[model samples]
Target: MTTTASVQVYTTNYCPYCTRAKQLLTKRGIAFEEIDVSNDDEKRAWLVKTTGQRTVPQIFIQGSPIGGSDELHQLDRSGELAKRLAAA
Candidate 1:
């Protein structure tokens, strides 16, 4: 099933990890809303407040934070991400 809410990605332009994370989501055919935090200090601060970490490529699936690129990749490798997407 397709989820009611779209996926979200918080990122910056120069972050390689962010690129990698976007590629993964793209490869899965999952469309997402990307929030670039490079210039917006308030957005960056909100990201930190919501995610509790200072990092690029903070992902959220159905409003739940999935963490950074590494964590997202881990989820993919372990098949959890796939499962979630399929269930959506």
Candidate 2:
């Protein structure tokens, strides 16, 4: 499927969830921008404030926050991820 939505993923170096999330996106042929917050305290704090989640692999689609890996997988399972991406 072709994706028009811009995807951003906030991740950490040692987080397995981050890897899984990226792998899923890759498998689906979805392009994403990965932001590593492993060493940046400012970015991490901003992520927490923006996403309301103190976890790695926070994802955003078309500038809308979409939670983490499990949420992403759930959307995929529910067939909502493509629908969201296809939204203009």
Candidate 3:
């Protein structure tokens, strides 16, 4: 059986890390939902509520928060990202 993973990225305009994060996902052929918190107050609040941090590019796969870009890169390096993507 094959399952499609749902990835969500909470981001803002001009965040270089956000761009890099998206590039990484795109390079992996992963589709994702991008939320722009650049000017949306409600979105910002929601991001903070869900992640407990005001960081751009808060990623979630299968409804699990995977943290910011740095954390994501770490996961990729440690080989856990593949596992998560597979699970998704």
Number of backbone collisions per candidate, in order? 1, 0, 0
For model 3 the TM-score comes to: 0.90
* Backbone clash pairs in model 3 (N, Cα, C under 3 Å; residues 3+ apart or in different chains), count: 0
| Candidates in order: C-alpha RMSD to true structure | 2.1, 0.8, 2.2
Q: What is candidate 3's lDDT per residue for 9-79, written digit by digit as tens?
A: 98999899999999888777778889888999998898889889988989999888999899989998998
Clashing pairs in 2: none
Candidate rank order under TM-score: 2, 3, 1
lDDT of candidate 2?
0.93
For each candidate, give its TM-score against the true structure.
0.89, 0.96, 0.90
The parts of candidate 3 lying over 4 Å away from their true place are: 1-3
Candidate 3, residue 1: lDDT:
20
Best by TM-score: 2
| Candidate 1, position 61, lDDT | 85
Where does the lowest 10-residue lDDT sum fall in candidate 2? 1-10
Off by over 4 Å in 2: none
Evaluate all candidate structures by whole-model CA lDDT and list the values in order: 0.87, 0.93, 0.87
TM-score of 2: 0.96
